[model samples]
Target chain A: MQRTTMDLWVGLFVVMGVIALMILSLKVGNLNVYNPSQSYVISGNFENIGGLKVRAPVKSAGVVVGRVTDIQFSTQTYDAVVTMSMDSRFLFPKDTFASILTSGLLGEQYIGLAAGGDEAMLKDGDKIMKTNSAMVLEELIGRFLFNKASEDDSL
Target chain B: MLLPRRLVSGIQHIGHRVIEGVWRLGVASRFFILVLLKSGTSLRRFNLVIRELYFTGVLSLIIIVVSGLFVGMVLGLQGYETLQKYGSESAVGTLVALSLVRELGPVVAALLFASRAGSAITAEIGLMKATEQLAAMGMMAVDPIARVVAPRFWSGVISMPFLAAIFSVMGVFGGYLVTVVFIGVDEGSYWSQMQSAVDFRFDIMNGFIKSCYFGVAVTAIAVFEGYDAPPTAEGVSGATTRTVVTSSLVILGLDFILTAFMFRGVS
Candidate 1:
């Protein structure tokens, strides 16, 4: 009987510990708490996503205001379309240009919005018209090397 | 010419031994699986296995939790020191969470359980076999595999994932406590960084899957060695040692294989 009670207590503690960890994960991990009715989705087109994964933060002027919810390729244009769900409080203007920006030299990619001072706010299902796609680091390096090689050839 | 011939003969002898060992292992594995399946219907066996899991997996929770806490703290401290060099101390949460969820948590919990549960199973089964209790059961129309081996296998299969989960959670909290309280990371930023760093798609399911495999390897090897015990005290001791060593190696090897398979596309 004593062993049984001890077992029960241990089981309870283990269950509670698991629950607490999961709760902490939810709380700390900042998993999306979706309110379908209130949230607005806006899409941005990018030539290359680079490391712009889903759930990467969407920051406006260096302050994170939303997250990247989905990424799909436009079959016709052969470009990536990233869907961002912004908090209802921060209304984006239609002219706001979304750029795929890297946090640092070797850091992960995130969507950065440069908000424009416009009267009209972007509604759900609207596309951000002007977009700056991900800058391919390798391409830049290639261009620099190519220019250097051409200069050497000229010499 | 004589030396070359002797060396060739030696190599051939080793090859033959290797094949014989592999054949023996194959037969043992089949027998083990059959015994496991047959034992499932016996209420006494079922109860014994459940009790073993409770003792082995559930009771080991305190040790897993304490170890997890220290692991998280150490990771956080080390990660923070390095990140601070780059003025990116906020990334520590990401570092800790990713490390704990991806590798440390499952591996540590498994090793801990292996030492505790693996040793116990080996000794208990080996002692039973050594004392002719196993033979007595066989005489009474009772199958030892069905009665003994199955419960340990199932217990391990069930308990490992639960223990791994517990380890991961505790480790995360340990990191959080150190970072938030000791290191002076703001509660909001610390948590936000962890959230953004850990994607459910990336870490959670893989960790659980790895733990399940570890459990299976640990239990199977331990029980196999126990069943193969010679009828002597020294033989039981040797079986216990082999059970621990073999199970640990198999667990690590399987972990590497699983990681390679899971991360094949990513890296």
Candidate 2:
């Protein structure tokens, strides 16, 4: 009986430890499985999203107002459609332009929204007309390097 | 002509021995898997394995937690120092999370498990074999491999992931405590950075996969050595030592291979 009780205590401690650790991870890591209440969906059309995937953050004025919830290709236009969920409180004018921006020199891509001064606020499911797709860094780098090489060759 | 012929024959013999060893290793691995599968179906053994997992994995939580805390603190302090030079101290969260998930958590937990439960398992099986208890079971028509080895393997498998998860969470908390509580990093920024830095699916999957592989390697080496232990007490002790050393090396090697494959293009 003593051994059994000891075993029971040990078992309980292990379970509680695991639970506590999991709670800490969720709290500190800020892993959000449930969507926030004050968010509405906004869509953007892009030619390329680069490495951006679903649930990527959407930043406006350098603050994360929402996240990319879905990415799909439009059948008719063959353009990549990225759906972002933004905070309802941050009203975006209908003329707001969205661009996919890299976070840093080697960082992941995020959707950056530039707010426009139009009086009309963007409603849920509204599409942003102006969109700038992800700038392919390798392409730009290659162009620069090749141009430098050609210039050296000419000289 | 005789000397040259002898040298050629010696080389040919060595080649034949190498092939034979490789063939034996292949057959041994196949037999090992077949035995595990056959014995894994026993309900009693499964229950025992679960019980052992609770003891091995759950009991080691305190050590893992404490070690994780220190590891996180050291990582944060060092990472902060380096990143501060570059004016990117805020990336401490990303660095800690990535390192803990990709490397430290699994390796630390595995090493801890090896030291704590692994030695105990080797000794227990070795003692059983040395005392002729295993032979008694065999004479009584009880398969020792099914009863003993399978349970240990399953227990190791189940416990490793649990331990790794515990290690990861504690490591993160430790990082948070040092960065936010001690260093006065903004709580919001720290958490936000961690959130943005780690994708839950990828990090968790990486940790789980590494732990599972570690589990199998550790248990297999320990049990194999124990079963194949020489008859003397000295042999049992030698097997125990070999188990720890071999398991640690294999775990480290497999970790390198897994990390290379998992992050092939990313880094």
Off by over 4 Å in 2: A1-3, A13-17, A28-30, A33-56, A60-96, A102-109, A114-129, A133-155, B1-24, B40-42, B45-47, B264-267
Candidate 1 residues lying further than 4 Å off, grouped into runs, are A1-3, A13-17, A28-45, A48-97, A104-106, A113-129, A135-155, B1-5, B42-46
lDDT tens string, model 1, B142-209? 88877777777777777787787778878878888898899897777677777766655446667778
- Evaluate model 1: give its TM-score: 0.79
Best prediction by DockQ: 1
Q: Each model's RMSD to truth, in Å?
A: 5.4, 6.3
Worst 10 residues of 1 chain A by lDDT: A28-37
Query: Which candidate number has the best lDDT?
Result: 1
Candidate 2, residue A120: lDDT: 91
Each candidate's chain A: what TM-score? 0.75, 0.73
